[model samples]
Target: MKHEDMVKSLSERVPLLKKEWLGIYRRMGEHPHAPKWNTLCGDRLFEADLESVRSFEGKLQKERLNFRELPPESIILWCSEMERRSQWFESVLNGIDIKNDWCRITPMTRRDMQSKLEQIVPLDADLSRLVVNPTSGTTGHPIPAPNHPAAVGCYDPLIQYALRMNGLNTDCSGDKVAAIQICSQQKTIVYHTVHSYLEGAGFAKINLEQNCWRTDESSAFYINDMHPVFLSGDPYSFLDYINRGIEYRPESILSTAISMEKIVRDKLHGYFRCPVVDMYSLNETGPIAYSCPHDPSKFHILPNDIFVEVLSGTGEPVPEGERGEIAVTGGRNPYLPLLRYLTGDTASMNYGECSCGEISPAIVNLGGRKLVLFYGKSGKIVNSIDISGIIRSFPVYTFSFIQRSDYRCTLKIAAGGELTSRSAKFMKEKIESLFDNEIKVEIESENILLKEKTMPFICELEL
Candidate 1:
């Protein structure tokens, strides 16, 4: 956008964008790419929201009872509102009382979200403020979620809380850039913007790919020049960032999109001399939990609004400390009010006091989502998320892509409709192109690609 239009856009979204920050804002425009600021609180409501998060953080630092079933305060009112305004909830709660017999109500699945979103969203939700976030992070199923600007902007405070828990009290204010979300994708958008929530500290999302910059060294130069206090990205991108040999030292790195293995986490910390936090997040639900600083195996739930639960195969709530599918209810996203939404991920819930002193329940033994890597013909590393993006376009309920040690790939897809040879061939060719046509690919139709859980990406190559 032109400088005049950019100014108007920024002014509308962030009414409080500081006059001093205009220099950094203008500087951001001079970068290689144009800037895009999708969501910020329309007014000064973000100020009150930030204060609320501060109060919640104070409570978070104290020991308290970890509620079982539903979070007591939010459940009743949320259910009544959903029943009154949500078509899906109204039908599901036809005769069942969610308050007294919450277990009787069927847990919402991703399939429900995929097929019946219009009915699920509350009728009273403000459509004017809605923004769609396209996601296929897990399960290889692309579902676009509706979000609001204020809710998306709320992530800043929650992120700050996670950083404080990790023993890094950061200052992402003034003229300094607060953070950069780096990506290593073959294709992605790169932009920078000043956040009103961070008091005009700049934030950028840049791709580490060679073509993104004028020269090979320009990527490193740009990052060092920005000098962001911290960084955020998936494990694959972080690895790519390190491999590219960027010399900028960040206070910490927040890893999300997929579960980070211990080896990768340890390697990141060792290289950067910073805490590498594994955050369990989804585009559908925003930020869910962050890895406990005291215990790597445990993830402390982040937002106070959501209620977390573990459900058995039959959808019954499992006994505390038992392994089951992770389901969540209630979130800050006004456009998407979730009720017992099954995350399609597994973890055992722990209600007892944690060693980290976070009374909010911790999800232990989290499983399902993982960081898997593939190799291109030119020895280029491929991330699972990219592969997921390609396959998500196909007519498949779910899929499993496996790369054997020989680099031969096999895609087993549970077809959403009747599988045709031509479509399968196209899917096979797409997978081959992802590997630069270096590897052979076989497309197979399966009645059920997933068993108890979905492991969409698997690699056997030793690299």
Candidate 2:
């Protein structure tokens, strides 16, 4: 679309676009070294929809967030609403007693989202407004999740709430850049767009790779010039940003899409001299939770609409504060009404007040993705969780574990010279014992994990 046409489309969708912010938006596009944007995208939110988001954000600030009831009454109403509006929900929730809990209903998994998406979408949903969001699928099962403009727009407010919890606010004027979603991966969509909800503060999703820019230093120069109010990206991307030696500082940082280690967060906080928030979010479910300001190990839920629960393997709720699979129900997405959606992450649910002054329940010991198993040389299966536990013991920054079909494994670590030779040797031995003394563990103590797209765990052996 032409630049004028794009603005026109945005104005049609969001009538509240300010005239002053157009300069920033145009400047971001016309920069000499601006990224070769793959496509044009915008938050297709109508004015009223954005107002609803602002209202929810206000409510989030006003309310003392509390622990979600096993199946909150709001969830019951949402299910009934979905049943009336969706064919899939009507079929799946046909005769279930939802008031009790989600124990009886089969929790929705990634497979359901991958194959039964059409059935999962509400029948009354507007197809024209629905956005197909492709996930990176760090867990190995990538799915194109159904989303909406208004739903995507809500992320900003959630991010704001997270910042507020940490005693920092990212809400800025139209003349400034609102936020930048940076990616350090080999391939990703790079674009510069304006958010109507943000009052037209410029937003850009740019890649830090040298190929994406006009020169090696162009990325750093552009970033320094933009001076986004806050930075949003994965842990690896943030690490890459640090390694690139960009000098710009923002009010805060929102790290999402993957779990970030404490050592990494501390590193970012120290270098940036700002709050480094570890946000637990997914494309399917936008902005699940944010790390507590007082404790990086705990995460406080963001949305008031969603009810989070921890369930056992058999689809039963575990006792309060016990570790189990994190399952979520109810969300603001019109296209996807999640009902007991198994998030594939594990955490213990804790209720009551937190040191951060939020009265909501916090997700403790939040683990990433589902259980990934690697085969040992003796053909025994080793859980990724065990390996993660071992890694946590060391002063590791970022690491990747990959096992080949021949039972050979390599653990690539990036510790910024924090791991001593003896510590590295001991860590290698500990990982080897996890494989029952079968596979020799190779450790690469370099800064490679931050430069590329590396999975935390990869298993090639045929199970």
Number of the predicted model whose lDDT against the real structure is largest? 2
Q: In candidate 2, which residue pairs clash?
A: none
RMSD to the native, candidate 2?
11.3
lDDT of each: 0.77, 0.77
Listed in order, each prediction's TM-score against the native is: 0.88, 0.78
What C-alpha lDDT, on a 0 to 100 scale, does residue 458 get in candidate 2?
Answer: 80
- The sequence of per-residue lDDT tens digits that candidate 1 reaches over residues 1-463 is 6868877877776666768887876665565533232333233335665565455555545523367755566666787778898998898878986778788778887778867889888888879767765564555655667887677776787787788788778677778888888888766656677887677878888788777777788778777877788899988889989998988879989988878888988889988898888888888888888889998778988877788899998878898789999988887787677888898899998776678767788898999488888897579677777777777666666778899988888887777665577887887887677778888888878775455365788899887
- lDDT, candidate 2, equals 0.77
lDDT of 1 at 277: 84
Which portions of model 2 show Cα errors greater than 4 Å? 1-16, 369-456, 459-463
Model 2, TM vs. native: 0.78
TM-score of candidate 1 versus the correct structure, residues matched by position: 0.88
Residue pairs in collision within model 1: none
**How does residue 358 of candidate 1 score in lDDT?**
75
